[model samples]
Target: MNRSRKIVLFIAISIDGYIARPDGDISWLDDVQGEGDNGYSEFIQSVDTVVMGKKTYDDVLKLTNNQYPYEGKTSYIFTRKETSTNLNLVFTNENPAAFAEKLKSEEGSDIWLVGGADLLDSFMKEKLVDEYIITTAPIILGDGIPLFKANNPEIKLNQKSTRQYGEFVQYHYVHA
Candidate 1:
């Protein structure tokens, strides 16, 4: 039995399997943000914390009127460079799995691995990801930041469940 606090990954991808445009443009996602007829809103509220890459943070900041959804939840940001602004925010320059283990040791809630591809790739490479919940939108970007970058390692997933919401399809995949 695994006693570790699970790290959950929640993302919205296109039907063609892309997270954002090649330039990190996620204008399409905004249209269907939290529009899932399913329990996605509940899913987001259930999490205790969220971890994201530096670029993802920047992108999200631009999209969300500078208000981070995980403001109440413990938020962790992974970045090699230092930011003088995120003083109160948990920031780390360490490996994903190692940092995750540390977070698991401390008293807290569930962890969310939010991404911009690079960070997701690192976690996938370390095999630290426990559960994946993806919302697949209807339209294709045709070009933009992919859900997984080219540098990511190959992985296999076991489908947990699927739900249709508006023009989006949600896919829940767990470790195979």
Candidate 2:
């Protein structure tokens, strides 16, 4: 039987494990020692679909000129509030775990779990994530939104690789 598509969590966090500030500010990520791609270009190329929380989607919109960045890939925003859909973007109120299971069963390139803490918690709770690619910037936010908010029971992961670029360290892990 063909296996389900991999669900990968690709995100950056501060050294203290915060993905953003209290008000959802990620300005701290702007300081990187080296220039050029930082492997993101290659990483994104492997993703055919993206699943994100409403807050994350809104945050991304703020970065663009009010334009959707993942124009060519399938994008789904998990939201409870009414939201309008545009090309390549769909807002769904479906159960996250159910939706994720259906998506993974489909034939496609890996799915990218672009996140907010809530969405991450839901997916992790369902044990839907297949791999995690986290890049840590060498700065700590004394207090902020953590990478994982829920009191998740331990999940085992096998380290696949580790790479360092200037002050950033990227860890690649697969569910074990």
Q: Point to the candidate with the largest lDDT.
A: 2
Compared with the true structure, all predictions reach lDDT values of 0.78, 0.88
Model 2: per-residue lDDT, tens digit, 29-134? 8876744666788889999999999999989999887888888999999998976677788899888788987898798899999998899998888788899999
- Runs of candidate 1 exceeding 4 Å displacement: 1-3, 30-38, 83-88, 151-154
The most accurate candidate by TM-score is 2
RMSD of each: 2.7, 1.5
| Regions more than 4 Å wrong, model 2 | 1-3, 83-85
> Whole-model lDDT for model 1 versus the true structure?
0.78
lDDT of 1 by residue, 1-176 (tens): 54567788888888777888777777886676454345666787767778899888888888889987566777788889873436347767887778877878776556888886888888888888889998887787787777776655667889999887766778889888
Candidate 2 local lDDT, residue 58: 88
